[model samples]
Every structure is written in C-alpha cells, then in structure tokens.
Target: MSTPIFPIQQPASIAAAAAILRDGELVAIPTETVYGIAAAPRLQASELLLHRFYDADSWPALPLLLAPEVPLAHLARSNQWAERLRNYFWPGPLTVLLPAIADFPFALPTPCVAKRVPDYAPLWPLLRALGGVLIVGRAAHTGYPPAITAQEVAEQLADDVALILDGGRALFGLPSTVVDCIVSPPRIVQRGIISAPEIMAALQRPAERN
Candidate 1:
C-alpha cells in the first residue's frame, strides 16, 4: 500500500495531519532535530505502523515525543528526580527515560519511558491537539543513511508514510542524546547532537541536589 503525503505549509495542516494520525496512519512530521514518523499515542495500529516503518525490533514499544508544555504528571509516572530533569532540559534536545504507564501504547521493554520535548513551536499545536501519548522518534530509512532533509524523507519513506510535512532540512542533522534516567546514576546511551558534559551539568544542577 502506498503512503499518503502532506506538504506542511501552515498550522492549519496539522489538524489534517492529526485526522490522518487518528486513523492509525503514518505521517512524516518535522521537528527541530529531525523529521519523525509520528502517530496518535493511544492507537496501537498507528504505533505498529511506525514500528514496522522503522523496522524497530520491538514493535509497539516505542519512545514518545511530547510537547514541552504538556504536564509531565499527565503522561509520565514521575518522581522527584524525573520532575527535576523535565523542569531543567525540556523544550530542548534531550530525551529522558522515565517509568511507563499502562495507557502508553508502545511495547518498550525497559522499565522506563523515553521522552523528548523538541524546540519546534509550530509542532506544539499538533502535539497539544493530539491529546494523548504519541510515539515519535527519528524518521530514518531502513538500512540506508538517516534523513536530514524533507526531500530525503520523502525519497526514503515515500512508500511508508501517509503524509510528509516538508519543512525543509532539519536544523540539526542528528537525533537528540538519549539518557537513561531510570538508573540511579543516569547514563548516556546514545550521544547525538547534545554533548555528555552538557547533560551531566543539567542532571547535577543544585536544584537536583540529591
């Protein structure tokens, strides 16, 4: 089956994208870091589609990308430490791990849930409008190089995604740094655009004096 495509010219189109997403369909959406394959959070079918597109080893168990302002308590099982981290590094290029909720659609084996609040303001309306957990991650093509431009996304995932919001090349050509906050000493698993020292500084803030 051929995927649908949408050119993201303005905010209004996000509603259209959301409509598509609600139907368990795939959309190649733009973010500050990279284009991502996004689906409505509660829809298992949409999550499965995204997982298959990425060839993710664990289908349905995927990380979620959230709007920065979305209340952490609503979507995550937060503790003092998790709250501190969210307060510090959200709305930027950091993906933190926290405990998962039963409502979460993905099938992540890790006891913690990985979350990202990107810097794209335009994308926030869509995130807020979606109103549930959304499984989003870097939209890279299978077995090929990662995509930095919308054109690359279209070229690579043309056959998979129902919509492609071409907002041009990503400001950052790499994925965000993923840190496992579930552990006592948070560890950096995948280091991307954000550096290790910067993360350590954020984690070791005086407010988080634990």
Candidate 2:
C-alpha cells in the first residue's frame, strides 16, 4: 500500500490520519526534533507492528507522545522531578523519564518510560484527536540518523509507515534531551538540545529557596 503524506492544515486529512490510528496502524508524524513512526501502543496490532519495525536496541524504552492535558500522575508514578521538568520545558522537546504505572498506555519491557508532549503547533490536534497519547519511535531504521523531514521519513520507512503528517522540517532537527526522574536528582540519559546544566538548574532551583 502507498503511504499517504498528509498536510496538517486540512481538517479532513487529520481526521483520516486519526482513523488510521484508531485502526491500529502506524503513522509517521513530525515533532520539533524529528519525524517519528507512531503507533497506538495499547492496540494488539500496534504492539506487534512496533516490535517488528524496531530492533532490540531501540525497543527497550520507546517515546510516548503525550498531550498537554494528560494527567501526569495517570501516566507515570508521581515524582517531583518529573513534574519539575514537565513544567520547565514541556509542550517542547524534552523526554521526562518516570516509572510506569501498570495501565500506562502500553506494555513496556522496562519499568521506566520516556514521555514527551511536543510543543510543535501542528502536531497537537492529531494528538488530541487520538486521546492524548501515542507510542513513537524514530522514523529511520535503528542506528540511522532520524528523519528531519516528511520526505525523509517517506523515503526511509514508507513501507512500514501508513501516513506521514508533513509539518515541514523539524525546528530543532535533533533528538530531544531525556531526563530520568526514576532516580533522585534525575539523571540525563540522553543529551540533545537541552543541556545537562540547564536541567540541573531547573531541578535544583526549588531547593535554593528552602
């Protein structure tokens, strides 16, 4: 089947994309960091498809795209650091790591999950349409650089991805910074646009007032 590239400007296209997701198919979408192949993790079909598309290395901790409205406590175990980071740089590129609750959107091999609520304007309506959460992995094959444009995603994973939501080139064009709040004084698992120092400052700022 030919993968369709949908423009976010049209309401019809967004609706179609949502329907595809509702059917448990993969969709390649854009965020400030890069293009991603997203799946509705709770669906059995999506779970099978994701395990097939991504390799062992890339499968351990997948990114969960969350809508801003999603209750933080419902997704991950309550943690001060997760809340701090979310308030600091959410609706933007910053994956906050936390221990997953039993009902967390899908099954994860590990107890911790990396979650992000993209700040990009164009990705919101679709996310909102899908009930505020989707499982996403980089569109490119494991180990290859992430796809920064919709065409790049199409070229690399058209066969696997059902649709591509074109949102132009990624603004950051780099992987998101990840902070692991599963531990005290959250650890920086992967550094990208947001620096380690910046994250530390945000986490430390609250203590300074005491």
Regions more than 4 Å wrong, model 1: 1-9, 54-61, 102-111, 208-210
Question: lDDT tens digits, residues 14-96, model 1?
Answer: 88888878888777888878888887876475546555654545222256778766776655676665666677777877777
lDDT at 26, model 1: 74
User: How good is model 2 by TM-score?
Assistant: 0.91
Model 1 scores worst on lDDT over the 10 consecutive residues at 53-62
lDDT of 2 by residue, 65-148 (tens): 988888767567868888888778888889887778877655666776679989887778888898888878887876799999
RMSD values for the candidates in order, in angstroms, are 3.2, 2.3
Candidate of highest lDDT: 2
Off by over 4 Å in 2: 53-59, 207-210
Give me the overall lDDT of model 1: 0.71
Please provide TM-scores, in order, for all candidate models, with all chains considered together: 0.85, 0.91
